[model samples]
Target chain A: MLEVKNLHVTVDGQPILKGLDLSVGAGEVHAIMGPNGSGKSTLAYVLAGREGYEVTEGSILYQGRDLLDLSPEERARDGIFLAFQYPVEIPGVGTNSFLKTAVNAVRKHRGERELDAMEFMKLMREKRDLLGVNEEMLRRSLNVGFSGGEKKRTEILQMALLDPKLAVLDETDSGLDIDALKIVAEGVNALRSPDRAMVLITHYQRLLNYIVPDKVHVLAAGCIAKSGGKELAHQLEKEGYGDLAGKTGAAA
Target chain B: MASETTTGLPYADRFAAIAATLPGQSVPWLRELREDSFARFAQLGLPTPRVEQWKYTNLHPLTKAGFEPAVVNGQGRGQIKALQPLSSLLPAEEPAHRLVFVNGLFRRDLSEIGALPEGVRLDGLGEALASEAESLAPMLGRAVRSGDNALLALNTALMADGCILRIGRGVSIDAPIHLVFVGAAEETALAFHPRNLIVAERDSRAVIFESHVASNGGVYWSNPVTEVTVEDGAEIQHYKFQDESLDAFHIALTEVEIGERGRYHSFVMTSGGRLSRQEIRAVLDGKGAECRLTGGYLARGKQHVDNTTEIVHAKPHTTSKEVYKGVLDEQGRAVFQGKIIVEKDAQKSDGHQLNRTLLLSDRAEIDTKPELEIYADDVKCSHGATAGELEESALFYLRARGIDETAARRMLIEAFLGDLGEDLASATVKAALQRRVSNWLAAI
Candidate 1:
């Protein structure tokens, strides 16, 4: 469903993702693990088409076409989602109103009819219980004064709403409690299907116990240093990245 | 003070006689107030180009136009309905009290009232001064230099017809009192001053909504002053809406005094008039009083609106907050100048002010100044003013979400203004403000 060939990216003229390659087929869950500065977020931002993060070279092909050529909205319409690590606080904008606009935008881009308020409410109720997000949290201004856990849960709720083919969970589990973490994981696990793909980016191994990935790729200095099965996550959690320091400069 | 001259214009004598009556009032204190005001008016000379507040809004056109009062014609049912925006929002069918002043004259034919509390007095200012004059005696014609606002002096000098409403001690009025000022056709250049005095006595509570409506292209000048006194433990909510024609000019002054444990809330939504100025002075005379001034303004065309507010913490433990937001379009200009003063003895004073302006067009302009004068040693005061277009990040976010750029911008603007209205204690009033906001946003 997603393909990246020798992708080189830079922010503020400093190279972050250099010659990174990755491919995720339908229904595949891929985990991208990296050290503190291994450009994990840089890759996610590049895929979601955020401005100011320029792709210096190479291209990102999604379902066979150049994904980089499309605008962020167009990319979402074509089924791409990025759950931000820090959900933005937009005062005065209602959370439900924003989600409806986003959902309809994506749907409209695909030649789909818009949902009325009634239909949208139906969509919200279904996602609310599954994501464990309640009405009180949704009634407030979009993410304004929301706790970190609530923000993450709300992001999962949006991910559920968009139901994009490729979902990028960027440090979404960083600040969640264990229960919230489980709920977030279950929300992801329940959405897992052969037709959808997810790239779970995380800093700790605690989250891996909930949503087990099929593969783990250790990224160091912008390029993948080590690639292995699910057990590689356990090895990293046990031994740390000391052993990978030698392979940091190894050939791709 | 050089008396207003009929020297150049034929009907100038009427101006002198009307201006002289203020100096002849019984109270020596009132005479002093009028004389000082006349000096200020003469020196100021109807706001020349030098004055910052009147720079964009020129009053010369109003001064040069020959103005003569038209007779108080009978109220037109169809006409009032067309101009009234408060019809549905008001309890018109429930027989609530309403004081209607059409063309600056108190109209009893169009007004209704119910039994009031023992000490409550809702009557025309003249009648209130004639019979139950004691209630309004203390507040009838006092305009302070607290804010250095010259318009208040003009209103005090040229005060014509309005009402004095006093909700007596410990009285709580559930029904809102509507003070509607309608400006009918003015064959000649017309100048009308409507005065409203509300004294919410100790432990009393009430809501007073004063709306100014006007039509006709004939040059019209409305100088209105509203004095609200909230005694100890009283709560007063005042709403002032200005929706005059583009050719008309409006100068409004609101002076409020809050006693200990009083809560005074005032919101002024100015969306009309070619040239409109709203000057508010809130004096916290007692300790532990709270005052909030929240407002939103939408100016299009060559319209110019100025909202100037000064809140004084004269005693300790006083709190004041001011939030003024403006959306400017076309070549319209909006200005908000708010100052909070915490006196030397006013310790533990909390003061917060925010003035935000959104310029929808490159040609539009906004001048926002949030000032603070603090003499108290221990106090918390913050003032912020921001001037910019819509956020590109937010706009892009909404656009990326499929919300059209125009709809996204409108939504953001509505949210920006709605925050102020939503802070009202009464949801009904908030809803009314919201409706007006949406209408204005949609029109712009």
Candidate 2:
């Protein structure tokens, strides 16, 4: 469902992702582990079509089409989602209204009927209970004064609502505690289907235990150093990315 | 202070030609007041950039245009029909005691006044001047003086017609009094000065809404002055929406005085006019007096909007708060100057002021100045000013949720302005202002 061939990217005239390659099929979950400043977040932003992430060379193909040709919003309408590392706190924007606008936008793009206020509220209540996001939290400003756990839980709720084809989770478990992490994992596990693909980018192997991945790849200096089964996550956790960083000229 | 540029004022001939026909012409005191105001205006002339208070605004547009005095002949109902959309701020179903003015002349045919509560005076200024001249003599130019602003002096000199609202002692008016001023200049460029006087007697309460709009897309100038007095323990709520034509110029001044334990609250929204300025001066006079001022402005194209305010804490335990936000795009420019003052004897006074602006284009500009002068050692006072563009991260967040670029920009802009109206106590006024914001966004 997604393919990256020798993708090279730069930000503000500085190269970040160099000759990175990856492939993921339908219903497959891949975990990309890397040390700090190894282009893990860079790859996620590139796939989401954020501005200023210049593609100096190579290309990205999603469902046999050039993904770089579409805008950030177009990519979102095409079922590509990116959970930001640091969720933006937008004041004066109600969480419920923002979610409804986003859901209706994507629905209209897909030729599906838009949900009315009552229908949207019903859907929101179900998801809100599942993710433990209370009513007051949704009524307040989007992400404004929200705790770290609440922010992560809201992101998962968005993912469940959008139901995108390819989801990119960037450091979703970084600020979450074990209890919050379990709720997020349960939400993601419930959304898993044969037609959806997910790429979980993490700095540790902790999240792999909750939602096991079909494959694990260690990224070093913007390139995949090794590719293996789920056992590789445990191996890397026991030892660290010290050997991979040394071999690829990336500092640990 | 007169320079070569201040010598020639076209209004000298117009004021001379119409002094005999102005309101309250028969009264000697009113006539003397007009003459003295005109003389002071002639001495001060049009404000030049050399003056510190007028440094950011330029009156060259007024000098270049040959704007004649607007005449009230009562001949343009069709033109007013075309302006129905922009003139009314209240909902259609809402029962409002409204008074309409065209070219600064009160239009009795277009106004609707139900049975006002006893002791409440609501009518045209011209009518009041003709009958109750003695009662309005003390308030006509009491709060605002000719030396404070040259344009205000000019307004008093050539004052034609406006609203006169007075609430008696201990009376509370339930319905809001809506004032609509529509500028419909035909062939010749016209200029009108409207003077509005509002008085809330001891322990009285009232809310007043003003809408200044243009009926035709033509060159005109609307210079208005509003004077308000909140007596001991009285309360007054004032709101204004200025959406003049893009080819027009608007300059307005509002002066208010609050007595012991009295409260004054005002909110203004500006979105049109080629060059405009809204100046407000609020004085907290007695102990426990309070004042609150809030506004939102939007400027696009080559529009220039200015909001200048001064709040004075003159008595012990007086309080004041102010917040103003603006948005500028294209080559638009905006200016915000706020000054807060606590007198030497006004101990325990509390005052705060804030001004913020958002620039949407590289060419858009903003000049913000905040000043605080506290003489009392025990007072609490603070002020802040900021000018910045929209956050790129916030924009991306909205777009990444499948909202288009235009929709994303609209969402962020709405959010930026929506933050200003959260504390407004009037739901109808809040919704009206929000609709104006949405309309401005859609037009841009």
Candidate of highest TM-score: 2
- Model 1 agreement with the true structure over A1-252: per-residue lDDT tens digits: 899988899999999988888988999999998778889988887887778889988878899999988877677778888888877777999998888888888788778898999999999999999988999888889889999989999988988888889999999899889988999999999989999999999877788999999989888878877889999999999988766855775643
Instruction: Specify the highest-DockQ model's number.
Output: 2
Off by over 4 Å in 2: A250-252, B1-8, B72-83
Per-prediction TM-score to the true structure, in the order listed: 0.79, 0.97
Docking band of candidate 2: high
Tell me the tens digit of each residue's lDDT in model 2 across B1-444.
Answer: 132345345656556557887777788898888888888787788888887878898888898787777853322222465336664366756677889998888888888988889999898997787677898988787777437578888888888788999899999998889898888877778888888999999999998888888777888889999999999999999988888889999999999999999999999999879999999999899999999999999999999999999898999999998999989999999999999989998999999888989999999999888988888999999888888988999888888889898988888889989877876778888998888888889965
Model 1 lDDT per residue over B1-444, tens place = 123441222233454455544322555555555566655554445566567655545666665666554322212221343334553234455445788876665777677767776778787774443344444557775434443455665556555568878888999988778777777654566666677888898999988777777644546777788888899999998877787767777888788899999999988888878888898989998989999999889899999998988899999999998888889999999988888999999999999999999899999998777778999999999999998997766765565454656777888898777678768886666776777777777875
Tens digits of per-residue lDDT for model 2, A36-109: 99999999989988999999999899999999999999999999999888999999888999999999999999
lDDT of 1 at B307: 91
Candidate 2's DockQ is 0.82
